[model samples]
Target: MVKKLHKEGSLEPQIEDMINRINELQQAKKKSSEEMVEAQALWESLHRELDSLNGEKVHLEEVLSKKQEALGILQLHCQRKEGGAQRKNVLQECTEQISVHNCQVTESCRQRKLGVQVEEQLENLMSQHKDLWELHMLKQRLTWEIRALQSSKEQLLTEEKLARDKLLEVERRLRSPPEVGGARMVNDGRRRWRYSRGRRLPQTVAPQRTRPAKERPAPSAPAPAARTWSRPQTHRTRPAPSPTPLLRRRPEIKARISDRPPPPASVCSPIPNCFTNRS
Candidate 1:
């Protein structure tokens, strides 16, 4: 897309192309994330298999050592049976060793059966441990969810309290008579003030005087304000007008395939009318 945008050399096509590229990038990121998750799962399975294989290897090595120990005990028994005799016949020695082995075979078979039972018990315990681990993980997840829910409930309660307070304030305002802008006593208790349309104005502390209803006082005409609002100004002098600045809009150029090379780019600034003529 970048290459295509550079080749096109136009803003209009680049807009849509760049947006499409952004969407593609977002989708690609999601796809990569999913692939990463799958890879992680695969890695976990491989690690578990490796662990199981290692356990089996250890168990087999233990069984091999036990068998080697049994063979040593059998050899010792055969030597005791010989009892310092100079026996020349190999066949006679083999016959006697076989008869001795037959006598101990029953005990070896019983021990082998015990080993098998222990292996079965170990398997059962491992299964129970797996179940317990799953339950523990479930408990932790539920605990976390409960905490989150509790936090949300507390937040909701706080918001409800704030809303109730606002409601009470509004009800109080509605129940009371509306106040019109007039003279209000200050916290200082010395000077009186008034707020006309939210702007504070100084009030004089003079004695009240009554005038006849038919008598109208003659006063000078009020002065006009510079702006639409009658806001108090710092100075009475009016601001003089200045000439408005003029800016020329850049002409639009249509994309066309030309054999000639495109012109070099010009510097563009964000400040308004920086390139405009000052005259």
Candidate 2:
């Protein structure tokens, strides 16, 4: 009835309004279709996300179940281990205590041995030092003795040199002549002649007593021809050897040295000690 009324009155206006309503409905339908398509795509994406989440959950649940089983096994093993470890802990504790005690005993023994060795070493060193001191003293005494002997030897040498020089001087005096000037004369009651500067001098004779003429009858035994007197020639005499030359030839007098044997090995050598084991 209303459409008939609209058709009778202004049907063209009603038709245009109807057409606009239809176009609006068609546009709403198109918008609704687009909205439905977008919703469907969003729903599909959400469903896919849900499915992946569900798969991850399932996997996680399965892993959890396995882990729980493993945990149960571990708990049982732990119970067994706990029961066994009690005896093992006690045994280990005892072994450690024994080892510690042995180490301590060894340390004490080593310290005592080391102390004894140190004392022995100290004693040996002292003995060696004493021996060295004695040797040093002996060397000093010997050195002093040597020096004294050297000084005595020097003195003897000097005295011998002086004696040698005196001997040589006496030799020189004995070899030379006593007088060097003109010839000497010996005037006794009778005259004595001597050579002077390589020439012989005339001798003066003493006066003789006169004989009586009466006693002289045999003059015919003519007096022997007057004896011609010639001067005596001088002769050279050999000089005697000087005794000083022979006396001065003194033999080389060396000091008499007694050979002394070396000291015994016991006195000269050091005492021996056997090597000790370290372990």
Candidate 3:
């Protein structure tokens, strides 16, 4: 019976130790559960933080793409503006050159107009000079003609004086009578006689009277013979004549002439004949 008590007592110590261990195990289980919950909460929190970081990264990438697109648009706008400015500069330069060319053309036209006017004035002056020179030449020619006329008048006057002197000398000799007998006869016989009445009367007067008398006798003799022959011939022609001589009558010609207009009164002035012996 004592062995039995000793074993039961040992079993009680073992049972008490098992109980203490079971209690310790239960406390450890409770602490392990609390640690697992804490771990779970931390893991959930880390997953949430990772998702937020991914969304932030996507947003940043979209912003960078928008900035790049905006930069490209700005660069294209600047290039277009630069090209427009260059074109405007070129147009302005061309406009300025055109204005300069126009100014030069206008000036050239003005100079040409002035040159034409000057040329015309020069031509006019030259023409006037030519006319003046021609007029001066004509004046010189007229002066020479006047001098020639004066010289001709002087020559005519000299010739007229010589003729008058000769006529006067001739008249003086003709009017002077010869001295009769003695010393005058002896002196006259020694001198040449230019107009002795006895010597020149036969040569100058006898020939003049004889020429007209001889011509008168010749015409008179021919006229009588012609009249005698014409009278017989006219008598013979009168009997054979038809109407030819009657158509040629002098009375018909006189009648026709009297039918014409009279002389003008200005040319028909009557003049008194002072040499007529009307008293």
lDDT of model 1, residue 162: 61
**lDDT for each of the candidates?**
0.53, 0.58, 0.54
Number of the candidate with higher lDDT, 2 or 3: 2
Worst 10 residues of 3 by lDDT: 201-210
Cα displacement (Å) at residue 102, model 1: 37
* Candidate 1 clash pair list: none
Candidate 3 accuracy as lDDT:
0.54
Error of 2 at 120 (Å): 46
Off by over 4 Å in 1: 1-8, 75-279
RMSD of each: 62.7, 23.4, 22.7
Q: What lDDT tens digits, residue by residue, belong to model 3 across residues 163-277? A: 4565468557544532232111112111122322112111111111112333334342333221111232233353432322222333453454345434334333333322132
Off by over 4 Å in 3: 1-54, 141-279
Best prediction by TM-score: 3
RMSD of 2: 23.4
Q: Give the per-residue lDDT of model 2 (tens digit) for 1-279.
A: 467957698677777887899999999999999999999999999999999999999999999999999999999999889977987898899999999999999999999999999999999999998778767755664555456447545644665576567655644643342221222122223433332222334454443433354543356754433333444333333233333321232222122111222233444443221111100
